[model samples]
Target: MDQVVSEKVARDPTADYIAAIEEHGYVRIPQVFDKSTVDTMLDRVSAWFDKTVQAQSARMPRLNKQQPMVYNLQSKDIAFCRLILQTPVIEDILKHFLNDQWFSSVPAEDPNYILRSFLARSSNYQMPMHIDSFIPYTGSYPFIMQCSIPLEDQTRENGCTVIVPGSHKSNKYAEQSAIEQAIPIESKAGDLIIWDSRIWHAALDNVSGRTRWSIIATFCRWWIKQAFDIPGNMPQKIYDQLSNKEKAVLGFCSVPYDDETRGIDMKRSYDLLPEKVADYRI
Candidate 1:
């Protein structure tokens, strides 16, 4: 067996954050990226958000247009892809909570989780209390998880996130009556806050006189259905810029086959990844 974890903490570097999540259902890691780096990201995001919202407004509703959202950021820029993938210690924490037992798959070495969604959102008003996992279920492992990074300061006045402590284990949907119990989890720009998707949470109303922006992404086990066809929609230029591991996390290693003759294994090892998007997008 592994070392007696309850008695002595594991020597692994991700242990402290893991303990926080096990006890609180969420954790905020401060300064994952320095301000300079964050500033550059924010600049790009600001420009992208404007262009995206303008193009999308032609068909979207008036209310949705006010909030401004850019979906599938991985398809937009390499930097957005790196936001979730290249963060230090994050992958370890996610693996330990979501799917570290890579040997469960046929190849026995490929990762067992994939990025489900990547989007940029801004808050102009409050959101209702709810969970992101879609449906509730009891299990040792969560069906999904989320990470949010603010482009600017996140505080009560600017409409920071609020979550009920330890509520991820509630195994029930969030109740509007319980908003009084939820607490604001404030953090600075570039800081990351990750939570189990089952947690009861809401975004508070923004009254600080400006729109607030946050980059959010959801992750799930490899076999779960993605919000959209990430692998199928990956742009050729963006695909070329990603590393082997990055492509794997984006679902290149587990795309569904069109038919038997196309391929058999969805959980393929990294080496088996196609040299081009055409190889699998059929």
Candidate 2:
């Protein structure tokens, strides 16, 4: 993947991303992460899935054994996820949406952003139409955005994400015509899809026999609620292991609704923090 991105970067491939999002509310950045890194994550994820299946089996009787399933990203191989969250490319993308404010994975009072992984191991899972905005947010407070990166190539044959172009500003989802206007986004591994959360989107059916895997990290303004409660689920020990910059991104300093000025100041929200803290004893 690195070679792919390095070549794309040399040719300035990101130029289209900004322009596409500005015009159509979405854009695709090909080969965002290096291939080796992506392959490592895939292997790690598979191992994690197998481990979970074994653990679950131990808790149930042999007669009750069921087909193996891959859980969402938040629960499996957390360490690998942490590495992905802190990648520089992802952070650069976040800066466009979040500005200089502290961003975290933990949900605030009105959660604005969430970083989640989705794996379609079964053929039946389908996400419904919904916007990233807080449904109750009546006016223009949303300005929400979502980023989807595929761990595997996203082909129409394998259920790529389908969206309605420019639907983020419309009220058409209630109409039958809206369903007919959807467009599928197809790409290869390491491709990044950034879109307006307000756009009507649904996961396409995976008619192919293989599983589909993707990771999405959503970024929104500080005023909205996240889909998941980040801080509540993250253990204290895990939180302690993170650098202050990561903690800020995970919403540890304050709930999402707290005053913006009260949040931790992250010098590197998209990159790894310095190896040593000012008060470090190590």
Candidate 3:
């Protein structure tokens, strides 16, 4: 049965990913890209980092050589945009999580998911155990999810992410006991690991002496405030090149408030509503 299932997933990655995430609150999908693709991305990241350092050095004469990270890669490079927006498996999983209209105010536009943040972490960077849903919201559905793509091999020695399975179902924050039960997710280059934002997770210390390269792309419901102003900050040329769906995902269509003056307007119907409008009223 296991062999049969593995073979099935090799043919259809989306179905397997959905099942695995539903069961474990996270899933590791292997070989999403070939080695050559991974190598190209890594090279781009390295070049970006070098440019950033040169630019920053003029302002601060002595910058500490700590773990360096580049944020908002969608705006910085087209490769990241393709990886985050063009990947079919990623799009399918995001649709499953964000396309539901039950929790959205404007059902027509609310189901869209937007990129929250995209960053590449390198060197000895160890993150503290915590859940990504730090903001308070009145919804049972997951508000955010994150996809981690390693540009290099992630091993126990190089600080792979450690996670507590099924922790997303727990309504409470992670306690010391939950942290102790965390297990490392060792993966190879080009592998993609995704998890519910509410899951308790952390990265281990890198003792391998080699820089661990990984890209983290976080997505959230369209209504949630993005980490960066993607639509506003993105290069005009790149923004112009995006499709309608990509524009929606980058929050180009999400309005802050609907025009109540427009009579009999279904588009702005939910805009004039109060907080927790989805809740049943007495």
Which structure among the candidates has the greatest TM-score? 1
Per-residue lDDT tens digits for candidate 3, residues 1-282, read 011124253667677777767666788877787898899999999888887755544332122246667767988887788887888878888888766564443455433677888888875866777888884233447779999899999887998888888777777776656657898888889988888888888878889888888989999876788987675677766765666566567665453433444333222223343232221010
Instruction: Report the poorest 10 consecutive residues by lDDT, candidate 3.
Output: 273-282
Candidate 2 lDDT over 68-146, as tens digits, reads 3454454444564465456665565555555433434332222223343233232234445556554423233335677
The residue ranges of model 2 lying beyond 4 angstroms of the native Cα positions read 1-16, 51-78, 100-128, 134-143, 171-176, 256-282
Best model per lDDT: 1
Q: Higher-TM-score candidate among 1 and 3?
A: 1
| lDDT, candidate 1, 56-113, per-residue tens | 6366644455686888899988888877888756687777766757534433343467
**Candidate 3, lDDT over the whole model:** 0.72
Deviation of model 3 at 195, angstroms: 0.5
Candidate 1 backbone overlaps, count: 0
Report, for every candidate in turn, its global Cα lDDT versus the true structure: 0.78, 0.54, 0.72
Clashes per prediction? 0, 19, 0
Candidate 1 weakest ten by summed lDDT: 1-10
- Model 1 segments beyond 4 Å from truth? 1-13, 57-65, 100-110
- lDDT computed for candidate 1: 0.78
TM-score of 2: 0.66
